[model samples]
Target: MTAINLAKDGLWKNNPALVQLLGLCPLLATSNSFATSLGLGLTTLAVLTLSNFTISLVRGLLDEETRLPVQILVIATFVTLADLSLQYWFFDMHQRIGLFVALIVTNCTLLGRAEAFASKNPIISSTFDGLMMGTGFLLVLLLMGTIREVAGNGTLFTNLHLLTGTPDMSIQLADSGFLLLALPPGAFLTLGCLIACKNVIDGALR
Candidate 1:
C-alpha cells in the first residue's frame, strides 16, 4: 500500500473512533482528563497490536468456526499483560484512568482487527494496521481531553508533573474558567470540533 493510503486508513477511513466507531464506551467515559485518556489509549494500543500479531500467527491453523473465540482468548491474554504492565509502571495514572484500562479486553478495536484483517492479511500488514488504528484512537482521546482540560480549568496541561515529573507544569489560559468545558457535554462538543477539523484537513488534501 502507498504511504498516503496507509495514513488515510489509519487516520481517517478505518479509524477506530471516527470510522469503525469502536470502543465508544471508554472513549466517552475516561476522556475527562488528558492524562487519563492518554493512559488508557496507549494501553489499548498495546493490547490491540499484540493480539493482532498473535492472531495472525494462528490464522492458518485455526478453524473458521472457532476463530472468534480463539481471537478473544488471545486478546484477553494480551490485555491482562497490558493491565499488569501499566499497573506496575504507571500505578498512579492507572488509578486515575480506573476501570477503562481493564476494559481494553472488551474493546472492539482489537477484536475487529483480529476478525477482519489479521485473519486474512499477512502478519506485517496486520501489525501495521493495528498501529495505525490504535494511533487514531489515541489522537482522538488526546484531542478531546486537551480541549476539555484547557477550557474547563484554564490550563492546557494542568498536571504536567504526572507526565514529566515537573511540578506545576501548567500554562494558565485566563483568570476565569468555563465550567462547562470540563463536563460530559464539553467532551461531545470537543469531539465534534475535532472530527470537523480532521474532515476539513482531509478535504483540503483531497
Candidate 2:
C-alpha cells in the first residue's frame, strides 16, 4: 500500500482503539486523566514502533511455528524497557499507570500488528504502520481522557506535572465535577459516543 493509504488505514480505517477495539482495557482503566492516557499512549507508541521494527528485522529467519512466540518475546522486551523507563523517570505517573503499563504485554494491538503486518512487510513499512497505529491509539486516549477529565474532574489537564514535571500546566474549572464520568461506566459511555460519532462522520463522508 502507498504511504497515504497506510496512514489513513492505521489512523482511522483500522484504528486500534476506536475501530478495531484492541486495547480497551488500558483505554477504559487508565484514561481518567489526560496525563495518564498520554503517558500510556507514548509508552505504547515507543514499544509498538520498536517491536515492529525489530520483528521485521528478524522475520526472514523465523519459522512459522516459532513466529508467534518470538514476536511475543520481542514485544515483551520493549514493554519491559518502557515500563522501567517510566518507573525510573516518571515515577509519579508510573505509580498511577504502572499496572496498566505492565498490561501492555497482553494488548492484542501490539501482537496483531506484529503478526499481521510487521512479520510480512519491509522494515520501513512496518515501522510506519506501527507509528500510525500508535498515533491513532494515542489520539483516542487523548480524546477519552479529555472528556473524562473535563466532565468528571472539571479539569482538562489537571495533575499534568506527574508526567512533565511542570506545575503550571494544570487547569481547574470546578470544585467538584461529575464524579461518575471518571469511573469505568463513564469510560464505556464516552467510548460508545465516540464510536457513534465516528460512524456518523464516516457515513457523512461517504
Best by lDDT: 2
> Which residue pairs overlap in candidate 2's backbone?
none
What lDDT does the true structure give each of the candidates? Answer: 0.79, 0.93
Candidate 2 residue lDDT tens string, 117-141: 9999999999999999999999999
lDDT of 1 by residue, 88-150 (tens): 877766677758777887888889888988899888878877887888899888887787777
How high is the lDDT of residue 200 in model 1?
89
Question: Weakest 10 consecutive residues, lDDT, candidate 2?
Answer: 159-168
- Candidate 2 CA-lDDT value: 0.93
TM-score of candidate 1 versus the correct structure, residues matched by position: 0.89
The per-prediction CA RMSD against the true structure, in angstroms, equals 2.1, 0.9
Best by TM-score: 2
